[model samples]
Target chain A: MRTTLCDRLGIEYPVFGFTPSEHVAAAISRAGGLGVLGCVRFNDPEELDRVLDWMDDNTGGRPYGVDVVMPAAVPAEGSAGDLGELIPAEHRAFVERTLAELGVPELPDGAAERGGVLGWLHSVARSHVDVALNHRIALIANALGSPPVDVIERAHAHDVPVAALAGRVDHAMRHVDNGVDLVVSQGYEAGGHTGEIASMVLLPEIVDAVGERAPVLAAGGIGSGRQAAAALALGASGVWMGSFWLATEEYRRGMAEASAMQDALVAARSADTVRTRIYTGKPARLLRTRWTEAWSAPDAPAPLPMPLQNLLVAEAHQRISAAGDPSVVSMPVGQIVGRMDRVRPVADIMGELVADFASTVDRLGTLR
Target chain B: MRTTLCDRLGIEYPVFGFTPSEHVAAAISRAGGLGVLGCVRFNDPEELDRVLDWMDDNTGGRPYGVDVVMPAAVPAEGSAGDLGELIPAEHRAFVERTLAELGVPELPDGAAERGGVLGWLHSVARSHVDVALNHRIALIANALGSPPVDVIERAHAHDVPVAALAGRVDHAMRHVDNGVDLVVSQGYEAGGHTGEIASMVLLPEIVDAVGERAPVLAAGGIGSGRQAAAALALGASGVWMGSFWLATEEYRRGMAEASAMQDALVAARSADTVRTRIYTGKPARLLRTRWTEAWSAPDAPAPLPMPLQNLLVAEAHQRISAAGDPSVVSMPVGQIVGRMDRVRPVADIMGELVADFASTVDRLGTLR
Candidate 1:
């Protein structure tokens, strides 16, 4: 079952699991695929280092990687060139006003003093990347676009694969041109930042585009072996699993929150989900909770771009996270959430995937 | 533009367009709410005649009604049912061979030619209420679910309304219920059959589910102002034309294939399109050219379910359509093709819709 990507990543299956928790990452890796720790939410270098070390000690030398969110470019004409400084009082006012209307109370005084940094953004992402590369990371996958030349060079120096997630083929080609070894074609069905295309179509199109030039892994809306077999048929070397993991027993997260996510899964309809900047500063697919609802309202303020959106909602997210209010929190899950029926073990998922793949291949052979 | 659908169909904008020709239905009502069409593809004769004729002429002096392909209900309890008799031996052989290769084909030439039985399916559709009656034909709508009892009775009793089309909530929920006046939510981007989603999110979720509820007027991708605005903001009491009409000064079996529909505006993104079947017996968005080279491949089978997977190749749709060449025939035209650049007239479509019903009202007030 060692596919091209599995061989390259030194894993049994070419499954790449993305998660913020190191435990989940390590679990996926130990289960015979690569687990790329989502470094986007890691607040600081020191914290990431601890988590990486924790993963290292737990995995017993299993290979893993780090995932970042870096775009190839933003409005070069700079409509938002000065993204941070452009945070006018008006935009902040909009956020403030929206929170109030949505019944979101003011941030508890001294909330920041209690725990982590108030938010996660580009800068935080870059710093975390630096931290991961400094560690024994074997690969660096950017969630959005091409990694900077320096990051590409640095990873190459360490002999680590540098990969990028792309919503479009042009973006993947750009990453490949910039020396990216792999590209995860994250269609709209994936957990976070995505393009409008579904994985069913995007995977094959991208696979065709990156043939030999770069190995493309299918992401978004992938959960079962049928979907994976579909992806492979479309030409993806592997699958990047997200929503499925959230349903895994090995996944570490607020149990209640995961339960709420379960509720979301059952009620999951395409219309029930939306692309919004309720989380981070980009267009991401999230559960349509009150938090996202308020943002989507007619009177709601125009959401801040990328990091600003992340900053504005961080505290509210933290509040909801602590309060355990699913409605008020941004639950980032993909359309594939519909297929996640129960919380199972990671190894169990891998086993099912392998069996399904073999069976699908056999079934497909009969057709031929 | 204060055309009350109720006034038009002697009912209200709550009309339905259920004709296989989405653009035609969209155009009628967009000029101030007409009958809905685009249903028969489902092939259910729940109320075939009453639904079809009612859908064709119902919109109370306004256009209404839809037709869907409800062809598969015959195989009840795992039985091929009556449709088996419809399948000629040669056609049956093709299916056996095709299934031997994949699932089913959309427009099997032999099956199409073998269709005295399938045409009888149309007769099944034509059997609604005995006549168009007091229910003025405002709009017609159609889908696969057994035709609602009231759809036939109400449209007849009301003196107007009708609708049809397929594949999603946006298209599925015809303004409130089966009682919709007229609507058609097909997603063919440009043409031929259609797919599972996208007529711009299935015409504003079927114009909040059926047009008459609020005169929901949207097409697969109508391409003009009157098209974009009326349906989107100003109120579709105006237009919804498809890409087919874009080059047709006069409609002749759907305008001939256009050269490269890749202009930036229309290139929206491949994701914007969906592939489904309501035309033949499959589900395939219209993105290919030349018998789609794809359909000719070895591993190109195992399509999804009824009216969907078969739509994948639409049964070598071109084989019979390309001057009967079995190579270049593409069918069905949705609103998405408006991005095709060259303009003809329908009156002048090759056009386009959306909704923010109240805002358009507010904009009108401002203009005043």
Candidate 2:
């Protein structure tokens, strides 16, 4: 299952696993794939630095990466406290009322006060890049397309390749023009913020559009080795998977206290998610729950744009998580959630993917 | 490049082409694939019979199929005039106003009035089946899952197989239990009426669910041979393509007067379509134009349920097509429209698909 991506990234398999948990990322790296730690959950730079230090010690000398979220045009820099004032009261009230109606209690006193909007701000994302480059990170990825030109140059200067997620050909071309080394063509069926193009079309489109400029990694709707083979068949250099890892044993171990999210994910079908702007103030695929359904009501206030929307719901999300109710939790997942019916160790999942890819390829060979 | 579907259908390749034009259907059959002619456009049973006769004569003894639309539960039978009175006045006015705003002129005097809702009704669909069975049709497909049990029995009596389009595992399972011989796993990215799951996920899911009961034909987001290869990798027996054929030379020749639709399609990108209910009262993907965008406005009337909505806008559709303006033409297309950049002969498209599929398989074998 090796491609040029494996040679370029020095990984045994051409698989890139994106996760918010440092433990899962390290496990993926140890399992012969690139483990990309998502940095958007870190409000403080020091927390990310601590996680990277742990990752460096735990990866067993394997290569891993870090992902940061930054909008194309930098928004006005503001602290989490200052950004709280920008959220409309109506939107805030709707969130608060919905949470209370769902019976989600407030977080316990002094529970680390997470869910701040600072992590989404440009300033914090830049700080993430700075901290990631300081560590032995093999790659740096920007979720919302190419980072600023200086950021790309800084990564290149540090001898680390920079990858950007694009949902359209124009975006992929623009990322390459901005000096990105790779393009992760994320599709509409993916978790988190996504564009309207599905991976089946978006991948080949971006691969053809960014021909010879940057390697394209297929993302979204990929859960197994057969899907990975399909990605290569569509002209991708490798496969980038995020949702499939949420059901991994490492993920369950890393977030042991939050079993509700795992329970919800395990019980979900492909049709159980909805695409809405209620998450992160941008269109993202999220598990369809009572919380998301409330926002769909006719009178519900329109979700604010990114950072503000995330700020408004961050506390609500915390409460929903704290409530320990799987039916009302707010989480981002792709359509591949249907196949994540059970938990498996990261190593087992990687082994199964490789074996499946091999057998699928062999089966396809017979047709030829 | 053949699966069990090829042996069962007695076709050379496992490609099932869904098209409305008899000329295109005949070309696909003669070119070695099964061309399923869409019959919903024929409100008159005799018109469909005539087309089947034409297909029988042109297909050169090759196999072809017919597609009909009959909802799960039959609606009350009504004449086109009787159904016309059931459409709300405001809905009628909105369509008229939008047509006028778009400068779509009314049809010329003495032109045949075709956009009747009868084709969508159960009686008309049943008549289509009766008429198709009287011809040399090789298959009968229901766009909205399995047709009536009697319809399935009727097709079997003639030694013709029945195929159904399914979007979910449950739907596919039900189709098999209802005696369907093949299940077309149509995904969210498909043209016309579709389910929310994308083909990348839906294909494997349906294959797993249907097991050995029925062969699944992967549909949606498939335009080229590489995609067809991906479908086979995902466990599908064949590929069912609808939108890719819209750019074929046979289609252009058949609908020569409507070059505007072809022009709009050629200029479109994968992102040029929007999934909405304005077109058919049920959600369907259509080319994003002023017509669809107008319905998205805050004050636009909620699209009436199927049959009613189609009745309300049938004349508007006639006017829009009559006006010969590509900018406002309403057409059903999949995300694959981006790849339909030029018109080519049907045989050429079929040849490329076979060659592409073989090459893709050979390329995948190298990875193994």
Candidate 3:
């Protein structure tokens, strides 16, 4: 499983796992793969600092990375209060009405707010970069687009490589032009915000366009060892996987949200997902639930762009989730969710990936 | 370059080329690859018979296949006149107005209607099957969906293997259940009618779902040897290529329509294509052009269903192509068009694919 990318990153395998749970991140790194902790969910700087400290301690000197959502085009400037004000009355009414229709109860008077929208803003993302840079992070990846030039320079100053996710060749080229150390070619089957191209086409296009400048990582719909081998054969340096980690024991044990999502994911198939903007005001692939369908109704207003969309649904999602309604929970996942049937340890998952990749390569060798 | 599938099909390389031109098909078979002639353009059974005879005579006893678009679910029963009447006047007006606005000249009197829509109907597609089975075709492929059970049985009785193009895992499974000998997993990046799933996700899913029952062919976005190697690594028995042959000299010399489409395809990038229902009523990836954009405008009527939509635009497409206006032409192509920069012979393309596959396999072998 050793490739140039594995050597550059000092990992035993070229598998890069992305998740929001620090325990899962630490476990993956300790298991010989590079684990990237997603920082977008940690709106509080202090909490992010604590998570990084925990990751640093538990990784036992194994290298890990941090991922932040830094978009090339930021939405209009606004405070949380200002953005909340942008939600239309009808949209608010629609959310409340749909929750009531679904028999979802409201949160208790003193219940903690579970969803936050501030992290999606550019200012907060830049702060994430600051916190990540202060740690022993070996990589800093912009989840949405190319990290700002200043952010890239700061990471380079710390001798940390910078990576960005691109769905098209032009976007990958833009990242290369802006001095990104790596480009993750994400296909439409990937979870969260994605462009229309698929990985089989997008990976090779980006690889050919910018493989000379920097290595490209293949993402979206990759879950097993054979997929990792296929990614390498398509000219990608490694595989960046996310949804596969959701089925891991470490992730489910560390986060309650993962447990809730696992129940739905186990029952889902590849056709059970739909790409809609109801979750974050961007086209994200999520399990097809009543929540997504309600927003897709003919009478529903167009989803607001970016931060405003995330803001409008934050409270509604909190209430629904707090009520323990699995039917309406927002589970951001990819088409690969169909293959995630059971929970296993990070070590076991990593072992299977390396073994499967080796066997696939051997099988290819048998081809005349 | 050889695999069990190649041995089963008696082909030199596990490459299957799909094209509409008989000359191109024969050329590919003569060049040591299996060439499947697409028969959807032949609305007349006699014309299809003549073409199949030509392929049989031109290829020096080499094996070839025939492709027909026999959809599993035929549209609501109706004659050509009944379906024609179902098309709204406003839709017809929109096509004419858009073509005139683009300055496409009308076809000359008796200009031999360059395009036809009858082939998309179920009856015409069945006729295509009847014409093909009478010849010595090694394979019979359904381009749209699983062939009717009777069609599959008939093909089997003739000692010809049946294959179907599936864009989803469930669809592939269904094809296997209906007794298909092979499944071609096509992704969204493919030209013509395609589902939303990308090849990276779709290929492995189909392979895992039906590899035991049927050999799976990776389709969509494959144009080179490295991709072929990657597809095999992902568990495909072979590769089914379409758009790559459009740039070949054989296809260009064989069909005038191929020549018209080549101009737009050579200039297209991966992002330059759009999946729209304007051309075929089914969502098909086409080179983004004024013809597509006009129908997408706010005032444009909703595209009619299946045969109706194909009927509405067939004459307009004929007129546009007759004018030799590449900007407004309807060219069905895949994202791989970005890599097809020049014309080459069938032999050279096959040789390059073989060489690239071998070198990629060698490179993968170097990974420790």
- Over A1-368, each residue of candidate 1 has an lDDT whose tens digit, in order, gives 34667667777788888886677788888888888888766556797888888877877687999888666664212222354455677766776776666666666676562232322444556677778877777789887788788879988988899888988767878888899999899876567787766554456557767889988888876766655654565456778887678767666452444555555555565445677776766788887777777777787677766556665555566656655444665678776655566678888988888776666454433222
TM-score of each: 0.57, 0.98, 0.97
lDDT of 2: 0.89
Task: Please list all clashing residue pairs in model 2, or write none if there are none.
Answer: none
For candidate 3, give the lDDT of residue A324. Answer: 64
Supply the TM-score for candidate 1: 0.57
Evaluate candidate 2 and give its CAPRI docking class based on DockQ: high
Worst 10 residues of 2 chain A by lDDT: A112-121
Off by over 4 Å in 2: none
TM-score of chain B of each: 0.33, 0.98, 0.97
Which pairs, if any, clash in model 3? Answer: A368-B1
Ranking by TM-score: 2, 3, 1
* Superior candidate under lDDT, 1 versus 3: 3
Candidate 2 colliding pairs, count: 0
Off by over 4 Å in 1: A74-86, A89-110, A113-124, A253-270, B1-368
TM-score of chain A of each: 0.88, 0.98, 0.97
Worst lDDT run of 10 residues, candidate 3 chain A, spans A252-261
